[model samples]
Target: MTINFDKMFTFSQPGRRVFGFGTISRVGKEARSLAGGPRAQVITDSKLMELGLVEPVIEALKAAGLETEVWAGVAGEPTQGLIEECRKDIENFAPDVFVGFGGGSSIDVAKIVAGLMTNPKDLHDYFMKDLGVGRFENPSKPLLAVPTTAGTGAENTWLAITSLDDVEGKVGFADPKIIPPRALVDPGLTMALPPGITASTGIDALTHILEPYLNANTNPFTEALALQAVRIVPVFLPRAFKDGKEKEARFQMMMQATLGGLTLNYGGVSEGHLIGQMVGGRYHIPHGVSQGIALPYCLRYSLDIFPEGLANLANWWGIDISGLDIKEAGLELIKASVDLLKELGMPWNLRQIEGVNRDDLPEMASAIATQPYFITTAASCCRKINTEKDYLWILERMYEGNFLD
Candidate 1:
């Protein structure tokens, strides 16, 4: 970890608090002021309700003297209309505080709903580059994020990964207002996650940290969180996956995920996130699973284009390519990632997963190039993306059974 001296960039402070295991007892007092004015709308999915976690969150709100309404409609690839419908579900409540209590998708829905409380626009208006219908002049409502899965750092972030209309691509809607006022991380909440979910989301956390750590935009503050996530995910993910009942392991993974989410606030992300978004929107692959599949290749290819500060990266992640060329160092990181993905039972390449056809490759490549955040943030030292052809070349490799020659 690099020594970063900027005090304003510090992650842990007094007002922004975190209570680990058994902290559910404090939800009432902690949430009181935020939930005071109107009914508190709790945004969560039916799976969580079935799993019995919603009962605890509801009990906490009622204990806090907050009127609560349950919005549980989120399902399968949350669409723009779904967000609008979710906005409608709570439109009647006019709730003062929104509590997101599921995986990343529900939490993202909660963020969009909070934005719509004051800003009267649909998801289409907030697209980043094109089709800009909404301008984010107004602030978002107060929000509280309590994540169910161990990944999607949505709880700690202000960016919402929303689906776009007509394009079949995903774009982020970002603003400081989108950031939740508070994050409630209870590792106990993640203890019940099934193995497949545990792997995909855990990989998402890994990408969140890795991309920021690699991107040139990273600062010392976010770097700390990202690096810590990198160090901890390897150790705790396996423990949490093998035994969901491992309270300590689950708690640690949750905290680490919070750290990963917070990282985006400071370090931001690069191509890995953008490519993952493309694969996810087009193929219906889980967000983290697809990102994990492409990361090593992105690292290997992008490194050739940017050499500045990479030796430092090689040393930071403790890869052995230090004595060799920069490309070798990049390969070292990818090799380590490949080993970890296989161990966690995630797909290493597109062919490893079923149902995705070869015919879709061109459209998928174009979709990735269409959204340029990854290209822009590849590395501070990295140049503009070579061409549309360059993107297709990489996507063609993805069509193969192997990312490596």
Candidate 2:
């Protein structure tokens, strides 16, 4: 197998340390102090509110002498107009700080709004072609990212992924100015998660690790995060799902999720993320399920062309992968990945996503061609594929249902 030296490695430095528990008491205190103001705005979903997830956070802020306005309009994947709406609402509260208090989508929206509210220009001004508009030349307001789910690492990273009405995959544009001034992770927040959601988000973090590790630009630093994430999920994910109150399982999952986000801060994302986003948006698949569905197939397809990289990944997972020949090890990784998905109850084929069919493969493949991560991560030397064929091939295997030898 050949590895490209020029495209070999990328370096990344994480922005902040993580503090975790099951409560929101400390978040408000830290956020108010950091914002240096009395007014704090929270962005979260209605479902979280109904679950009483944000109550402790609100009370904490109130006790800390911080007035708050909760924006409960965020749901589904984030969009541009939603950001504008959030910007308008904050004016009423005149909040000096923004708190992202939910899952990846909610936190991502809050992160962008905080930056845009403080920075100049229209939200789209900094899009792909806008030369210098979105650059984080100056810091924005004090923003605190508190995760309700162990996902997206929005707490620890600067990248905000939002969907466009006209676009297919989530368009990601990152600026250092957008990184939250502080990130507070409390695993207690995830204690109420249903088994299905626990399975999906855990797998999503797993995918983030797998993606960066598989990128042609795989770095020694990223490799560590990816391997640890891989190791943690298989061991702790089931426990977290089986009993959401298990502090040990929940704590490690949160840390693993944060690590995955930090590791991918600069290192590239793989075809799995790119293709998963495509599959999710077009078919209404959730992010975590999309990650679980696309990742193993992507790794399996890339194995033959990148055997040396695959070996490194196998070693990172601490499997006795060397016992088999390189080619055999590569195939074993695919089997192991599929096994992980089954453990999580993830769907393997497009058909598993209600309403998906053979006819939809062309559209889905076409959609993946337009994904955002493709620009930064696609390897010119990686295996060239008739993506439509791969799309159909995966579905075929998925339809087979049980494990493939």
Candidate 3:
């Protein structure tokens, strides 16, 4: 790959990160250091609570001599109303620090709650509107993110995604102030994940890695992290998927997710995420599963315009492109990605998803084209999206699981 030193880009991540098999043990100590007082709240979901994952975290906080409260209400993709209800529910606690524990949705709820705790406005006030980005006037309460899933990279990113029923889509609140200051990534937390969750979240991490690497906003810092993550996913994701107790695979996947989070923070996601967000909110599909279904089709769309980047991805996937042209190499990469999804037992097409009828493609395409987030990502896409027709073209291929010819 050729270097482009003149291209300007920026990078940032959480102030502190502790990653290992037993890093969850240190959360209390880390929390104490970042907390302003003795009160700490853990934001998670009912499922995690039922799994007894939140107890250790609570015990850790109490062991650190902090007064802890658990609000286990976050479920599925967080909605605007859910955020409001969570903020209202925890209003009396007035936590000095927050621990976001669980998957992306839970962590995102924590972020929004923390960000809105001190600020006077509602979460909607800070949502990305059209081309203009919203800014948070006040810094959020100190937050520590502990991710159980190896996808979404919500722990490190400055954005919080929420679904809005009014828009029938998802929107994000983007601000540097809301990014978690500390993270404890313990792969041990994921050892009990079911195969389906493992497969979907693993593919989600790969999508996060690839979009940033392939987009126009990529820089040296993001490229290094993204490519390393790319290599890790193809090897270890399957191991982790087949055997959730594979410690080594789990550890590597945790690292890959964290790295992918950083890339996602700086380089940003493009077409796949744009489409994923749309379909995910509309059909209530798991975020990672939606991203998996969109991955290869979106890459095929990008391949027509930016073969060089996709070719590099093909090389990293261990494809022998010695005798192939750029297009051929890109196609091989797409094939490899699709094959990986199949191997992991992911849905190969939009039609395979429940409630996603063939007739819904046009409406979905229109919604995607006009969505502010999609508009923002379109600028970074390899191929210029000229109209709803462009999105429709990709949607059509995705519906049929058609390979690029």
Candidate 4:
């Protein structure tokens, strides 16, 4: 198949990305620079605070003469209520800059809070207008993202995701203005993450790379980042999962996660993300966990449409599928993906996750079928999504753990 070099694509660059070990200590200086003053708000979850990650940032901010307010209330996938709760704090304290200081959930909450400060609208107001949300006229205050986990690349992307109480699935607020002005990603912050989170988030980052790499909207820049992440994740993720204290493995996983973010910004994602969002939103599954459950089958389902892209991914994993048909080659990639999940002791099927049932398949399928992602444009998505039945089929297979069959 011939490639389309003429395909037009846009990329969003993070303002100031400081990636390395021990860089969280620079949060104070970065916040001061962005805030143009000493007032800063640190948004994170109670878990990270309990793990002793939040204090260092607060202490560093104080050491830099910055007055800091701690909002460690983030929980689960951020919801409208969670965002509103944080919004109240932002409204009352009114800091000069906002620092999102933990994982994707924490960072996502901060993104909405920052936007709310300037937009003065409901969360639904910022939903993609196509989805009947309001429009964002002004950019939010200079928000800084400090991600603790290696997935959800929410730190670098323009999209903020939330689970709405009144809605059945996740909603994304896609606005260029929401992209953070700076990100301080330190691998040390992830060292203490348990193996379960490490594996799940690693798969999420990998899916971020995979979907965009297969997206019809892909460009050279996005493909480059996605390919690099593809080459790195399968190797480093296992190491990070087995031993969270492995610095080099943790560092590499962190880098790939950010690259995954960049890929989503430029190339966009396809079926897997759409389906994963449904499972995550309805089942209350973590984004990464749902990605782990959905990606293998999603990729296999799209193999015929994304042969070249999926074939290249197999090659990157060092599989020699030269003589095999695309289906065979794609199967090789599927086996590799599932093997990685097993090696990491992660659940490769929906059944493995507690509370999942076959009864939920129809609702999950309907949710994904209505997503903007399933409604493709002229050249946005590579796969031909048969939303009416294909989604239900995938969900059933996922529920049954029917990978090879």
Clashing pairs in 1: none
Candidate rank order under TM-score: 3, 4, 2, 1
Off by over 4 Å in 1: 1-15, 126-135, 306-325, 371-383
> What digit string (tens of lDDT, one per residue) describes model 2 on residues 1-405?
244556645455645555668346677678777776788888999998998877888888878888888998898888877878888877667778888889998888888877776666776666663211134435677788888888677776767777555554556666767877777888878888898989898888887777766666566676677767766788899899889999999999988888778777746576677677767877777899988888767777667557666666666665678568886777766777777777777787666778767666666665555444444335431245435556556544543443333
Query: For each candidate, C-alpha RMSD in Å?
Result: 3.6, 3.2, 1.6, 2.1
- List the candidates' TM-scores in order: 0.88, 0.89, 0.96, 0.94
Q: Residue 35, candidate 3: how far off, in angstroms?
A: 1.1
Off by over 4 Å in 3: 2-6, 380-386
**Model 1 lDDT, residue 16, Cα:** 60
Q: Score residue 333 of candidate 1 by CA lDDT.
A: 62
Q: What is each predicted model's overall lDDT from 0 to 1?
A: 0.71, 0.72, 0.85, 0.81
lDDT for 74 (candidate 2): 91
- lDDT tens digits, residues 141-178, model 4? 88999998999888988877776666555666767888
Summarize candidate 1's per-residue lDDT along 1-405 as a digit string, tens digits.
Answer: 333245233233212656587665666566676764857888888887887878988998897888888999888656788888888777877988888878899988888888889887655566555532223658778778777788888877767766656644555566667778887777777777898888888888887776776655556665566556656787788888889999878888887777778777666777667666777766688887888887767666566655434444555656666368766665666677788888888888788778877777777666555554444334331234445566666666666734554
Which candidate ranks first by TM-score, i.e. highest? 3
* Backbone clashes (count) for model 2: 1
Greater-lDDT candidate between 2 and 4 = 4
